[model samples]
Target: MNQPHTAQDDGVRQRQQQIAANLRALILSGDLRPGDRVPSTSDLVAEYGVTDKTVQRALAILKAERFVEGQKGRGVFVTTQVPTVVRASHYPVTSSEEPYAWIADNASRGRAGSIVLLHVGEVPAPAQVAAAFDLEIGTPVTVRHQLLSLDGEPVELVWSYYPSNVARGTRLAEARKIRGGTPAVLSELGYPPHHAIDQVSARLATVEEFIALRLPQDMPVLRQLRVVFTDDDRPIEVTVMVKAGQHFEVRYALPKPE
Candidate 1:
């Protein structure tokens, strides 16, 4: 039987969430380094003015989300694997000299990154994808599904779409990997990307994402819908990117106000 919702339950849940948020902020801000021991449960309870049970629940949340681990007879410690910071404004100068821009970027950060082309074929455009392409809902489009990894661990899943008219008879529709990635192919086709806009959000992982990203739980994922536009303001490509939220954060470089 389902239990009735109550105000006390809501209060407890909010307090637990507050505790977890505080610890998460500290870890992400580098105030608590990897392998650093988190304060004891009794200490946290004292600090947060919550019961020991509430503190334990908050710690469990962190453990399930890969932020911390508990050791025998010892308190919780930050996991050795820390969150990766992605520079939102970085883009590769695509050329034969540097084909895989993403791999190169990760290399610069001292991490080995690679991509696996899981699928390439025609599919009915999803609602958002169709809208980006200025087509009616359920329009057909060429889609490429890829899984991106860092240090052999899955980090992101990407699905890129192109209108059939734009991608037909081109390498974009091919099942094999593109030598210079998609930007080079688009450029050669006279639709060089002039700019891109990204819409980002966070939500609990879907079943597919949980399995693909190997998430420890139904944790949140960072989702991005990016639309690339070329000369004449034509939408050339639409991409959906999903990353494990606990392990990734986007950083933007903002200009100073005049």
Candidate 2:
């Protein structure tokens, strides 16, 4: 039997959909640049004269679409760089499941999976990290840092963080033990993320990243930050992956407006 949506449910959905449309337009028109701060929930409520819950709904929708990402205490920001020309039909949905798989596949060809996991540990969360995970600052968090290689050549560096309480004693942590991908681990936690919001940008390689990727002084690197969310509209994970720009490319598949 088909059930009807309640008034409140309908209102929430409409507001969120509206927010998604407006946010997309802002990004595509370049009104919001990479790393630019987005309006806060309070600001949106005032500007749109909507309830706080309504604003949150909108932001949640944007997050699901990869249009914006929330930093722990850093609020949200426009994604840095998005490929201008790619349609949603260009690549398979699961083509690059892991954070760095896309660049690894393109740069290293059949060798993207050769990278080794360096350090994986649980530690106290920073202020920003805590906010992203909706936890108290100083809370314990699980952090995983890894290095990537291409045919024996180092090419990328990545750091991934998750709420320890949420991931501990679950398949998510077990998957990490087995070197399985984060998305799969998240699925085991009952929050299987099916979509991601990603932002890409370029910058001079940091001394640390340069040493890690073994890039020359003049080489730049690509930075990608992604937030993964469950279908029920909750944030699941956030990842930061960096790669040598000289050997990397970012691609996306956007659906054309009818």
Residue 81 in model 1: lDDT: 76
How close to the true structure is residue 244 of candidate 1, measured as C-alpha lDDT?
88
Per-residue C-alpha lDDT of model 1 across residues 100-146, encoded as one tens digit per residue: 88898789888999999999999999999998888998899999999
lDDT of 2 by residue, 132-240 (tens): 6788988888777778765566777877778887777765444243333566556666777766677788888888887788764445678877667687767677677
- lDDT per prediction? 0.87, 0.65
Query: In candidate 1, which residue pairs get closer than 3 Å at backbone N, Cα or C atoms, i.e. clash?
Result: none
Q: Which ten contiguous residues of candidate 1 have the minimum total lDDT?
A: 2-11
Candidate 2 local distance difference test against the native: 0.65
Regions of model 2 farther than 4 Å from truth? 1-108, 126-128, 136-138, 171-180
